[model samples]
Target: MQTFRTEIENPVVEKDIIDLANKIELFHKGKIDEEKFRSLRLARGVYGQRQEGVQMIRIKLPYGKVKSNQLRRVSDVSDEYSRGRLHITTRQDIQIHYVDLNRTPELWAELEKDDVTLREACGNTVRNITASELAGIDINEPFDVSPYADAMFRFFLRNPICQEMGRKFKVSFSSSDDDTGLSYMHDLGFIAKIENGVRGFKVMIGGGLGSQPREADVLYDFIPTDKIIPTMEGVVRVFDRYGERKSRAKARMKFLIKDVGLDAFIELVEAEQNAIELKTVAIDADVYPVSKPVSVEAPQVAIKDQKAFELWKSTNLIPQKQDGYVAIGIKVLLGDFYTDKARLLADLVEKYAAGEIRLSLRQNIVIPFVKEDLVPFFYTELEKLGLVEVGYNKAVDITACPGTDTCNLGIASSTGIADELERVLKAEYPQYLTKDDLVIKISGCMNACGQHNMANIGFQGMSVRTPDKLVAPALQVLLGGENLKNGKGAFADKVVKVPSKRGPEALRRILNDFEANANGKTFYEYYQVTGERYFYDLLNDLQDVTNLTQDDFIDWGTNEEYVKEIGVGECAGVVIDLIATLFFESEEKIENATVSFDNKVYSSAIYHAYSSMVNSAKALLIAENKSTNTHAGIISQFDELFVESGKINLGVSFSELIYQINKNAPTEAFASKYIESANLFLDKVRTYRSPKPLKGAK
Candidate 1:
């Protein structure tokens, strides 16, 4: 592990890697529990793959922005530590697979040399902060959201409050009313808006897609940019304290808002105001770095296929707000590209275009700041890399998850079927090459990693069994999903389930029917007119399993017999409410509070101290085998079980002591007093939990 220490410049990041290395050793020595160890590794972005003895390292890229050097660093790391393949995710993260768990620390250390990180990329902590790839150049955007998104990622990277939350939280920033960021499906969605010459965002909270999809409700129509960070901090605090903790399925922020009602949830967030460090922290948007293309004369290149060049140019080039500049969309097939192509692409962008690339939410790449006259030159250069395919963000550009390829949660082959469907579109529906209205996304499971439920046509991987007990890979066809635009949208409805082998046939029938009968209507508009039942009935015959074939028993991309095996997903860390662990965490919180106090961040210090007290009380409550689902519940129960019942006295009630955080100003005086109160309360609770001696004991 010391081998990486000399390579990493940031001491803080170096310590994180060292800590993970030490924990892994401790876990191997049987000093740490599997659940706790799993959480630790996951927060560092080391995920267990479907196959045993390897890991998937998710490299976090804020808003999908990667410098040319950073891209080369990742490629080098991939070549050194794992396979040469890089997989871009729907959240704008890059994942490299089939890595040995023991070498992750070294792998991370190498990536950090170029200022790239994997922290909080795969865990319950705020998963990669995603935004529109066209953010800085979008003609419809009021202001660039890149800086604000960066601020959020930096603020919460290792914040004490969200280190071990019940579920993962996702945040996205839409560049414009186009809602290209898909604001409707994130835990907290921010759409860029300017009102009265003031920059702000239209906030949407609690929207998510899973086994049960829920659309987020409008939180604020327009909130000033300065308030976004503070608002998010308060909201996360409320969630950490009151969000569901027992059942994994109900642990998402979406479920919490649903159970308590959005109004009540907002009230809780408002109550956390006094505990936030900065009330209106303004993000310095000007400091946000954006790369400009090198001013180079375009080199003439001969185009062998003029027809193909025009087709590619027509669909792949997006107009930029900057004059004489355009953004080129490279439709990365299934978001997979090798290290060789990666290094070449990095060099090409650095020489002619911007020295940076934005990974799109649709699992593609956008090279912004390309000069309009250099389109042909770029096409020829990219053609050498086999990246000049047409129909980027069009019907041919299908978004898909790894599915059975690697993801532990995948039940069927999403990538395999996605390849087939894309082939079908290119071969049969060539007319769709110029159409951008249709969206297709796929996921291996109900987790919606592929953003399936947000597409015009979606497919979810599943399994179906014949009467003879033979199981075959299947797909849950979802329809009628619409982007809706302007911070509003609808999730797709599950219309039908068909054998994986017939997935192409299902797409063909759906498209054929839509084209022949819709009379130029968009997919979503036609779906509304025809309704869910109408489509369900149209594809109902494909659901029959009685007439099974040998091919149906085998999953796509595999020649072996299909076997349904799903390992546990480490997307959300497990609940580890061990009494000793809780007490240990309380002390850690106190230490953090003291550190914050020294830094003069009084509000943060106060909140940390308050958390120490709550956790201490919760430790005692757990010792008594009492339920501690939410922090609000824990406070009420602590008072009832100890203070109110006169078992332990601290002059005043626990409610008054804990509630002081919200009632008083976040001054140095109040913060110090509150921390003292927390320390005293913890001492009392510690004594109470100490094993008492019997009469006439030694």
Candidate 2:
């Protein structure tokens, strides 16, 4: 499925991913067909993801290097075409969302001036080549492998053998044995080692741990540095030939490598690699130096004193082999940077700090080295850009992927929810920023974009409505998920199902209680020390179970609702927006269409339909308050809350929401009635029958 060609040797390129900067200049004036231009720009690897109506563009960082100009370009692209922020991905790639589909090509052409590219960033294609964030530095490293990484990337970029594989291929480079920088969670993880007096690598394959998690296996314990590419070619061959094709979920190299076992897989890899006669450059010390990256201008840190500079120095600095220079890591919250701020920072990096910047896996940015005297000025400049925040422990530092906001298969907006949760954590529990040894990740779907299964607390998106009612589905919460110091990271705790909106609060409560009562212990230790009986007792005591009675259902004109309930987490992203979006600045532009909520006339099902309605929903409106076909106890529970009556008058629907927000007086004030309403609305939706698309609907 792939055709090989060089930027020059390739024949007629109907697609020019890059072009004269003049076209880019024209597009800035809104004078070009940017989308038409984007389809051709090669440097910026922008492509549509699995989901429809969305674009996933990948920005290349040569050897994971970031320059001030490059960062400025990234910020500019994001501000002009995307959501004015960028996500620093685990793969060391920067991703922008909700891209103005029309402007991508123009963006690509402009990117070429920097020599960055997006080709092979994604698809059933080879992805952005990753390397150790500490490739040239890290005291324990054997040698800088940046050149090798660059060589392999250049050789295979859009190569016929790799362009369209049976599945996506991921690659990484490591300069040390401890696999923290280049994650072992990859299809190909190459860590440096010395074998038989020769500088080489320990190549591990298929080691991703998401959803159906698996550890990558080490096939070649010692691959001479010179032959790394051929070895990589071998692994790709094994993956292409044996990886599963029918089930996309099972097609990742992690699955194939696990299934075939390392021995057989390596044999296959070796076979394919043998066919290639690699006649390339010699591997020598002069191949690539461990010098400071090419500097456009020397920076002058501007601060006068040392105290502020010391704090900045502690958090922002990383040791590099280059003398008189240290790498400064600027922790970017949630990998988001405002465009104007980015431009200013780029200018600052150009003026006060290093001319280049590097994006880190921890969703942070780095600028390598300036004189100790300039560190203070650089700190002040960074402070102006809001890029100097320090992070602590797993919980408050969350990782979330874009969900339904701009992705195709997204079941929810994990990013928005993550942002909200981060705000809540920062505002409410100041201690969690430094105390909790936990991670919270939100995935838009069960596909594990958020790595839900690996977090101490994780959420995966899913549909939870019943047969008759159709409302926003909920997240399938996988509680007690964790990864301990390279130990077996457990997935969700199966028994507890919580609605997504309530999840943050619930987790907060648990942590709060643990912090208060546990005798000075870590979060995980506290949970373990407290044991299950105490944990359940505390949870039960917190919520008065007696209040959840059949009488509660009476409020909806239905018989008392009670049921044998099992829990499932609601997809938090989509459901949470039911209210938040009703208030976000730009979104508030849409005026409300007033509707009468005659609680006496519309039965619970009708009410539920109206309350739960959002972008896409199916509901059959009727006047009757009772149903002849259903009995009292057939239906059991809603994903959001437990319900008993088969045709329960659970008064919840989108119409009810429009009614509430537009009330003459706040109807659900002073009480958490909105939460109850959400649960009830979700419950009613769980009862919808065959969903039929609305005809002539907008």
- TM for every model, in the order presented, reads 0.96, 0.65
Q: Model 1 Cα displacement at 60 (Å)? A: 0.8
Q: Model 2 — TM-score against the truth? A: 0.65
For residues 1-698, could you state the per-residue lDDT of candidate 2 as single tens digits? 12322343232221443342444555466544444333323223655554444466778665567777788777776776777877777567788766544466666555555566666565566677777677776777877777777777776665544533445777777767655443456678777778778877787777665567665666666878788877776566456445554455676888776666767776766655433445223466565544444343435545665664565465456777766666667666656667787778777666655566666655666676565445555667767676666442235777776665545566555775677688888788765654436677777776675667666667665444333433333455554554442212345443343344455665676667876887776555665665545555544432332223233222111133322122221111111112122122111111111111222211122222222332112112212122111101111112112223334454442444423421222222311343345444433433353234222211
What tens-digit string does per-residue lDDT give for candidate 1 at 1-698?
Answer: 23335367787788888888888887888767788788888999999899899999999999999989999999999999998999999889999999999899889988889989988987778899999999898878877888999998999887767777778989999989888888888899999998999989999999999988888889999999999988898888888888877778998999999899989999989888876757899888888776677999999999999999998999999999999999999999999999999999999999999899999999999999999989999999999999989999999899999999998999999999999999999899999888999999999999889989989999999999898888899999999898888878888999999999989988988998999999989999999999899988889999999997998988888998899999998777775677777676677788889988999988778878988998889889888988888778889999999998999998998999898877887899998998888888877887788755322122
**After superposing candidate 2, which stretches have Cα over 4 Å from the reference?**
1-44, 49-56, 75-84, 98-103, 279-285, 289-324, 392-395, 434-437, 466-473, 478-495, 513-698
Worst 10 residues of 1 by lDDT: 689-698
Candidate with the greatest lDDT versus the true structure: 1
- Report the number of the highest-TM-score candidate: 1
Candidate lDDT scores, in order, read 0.89, 0.53
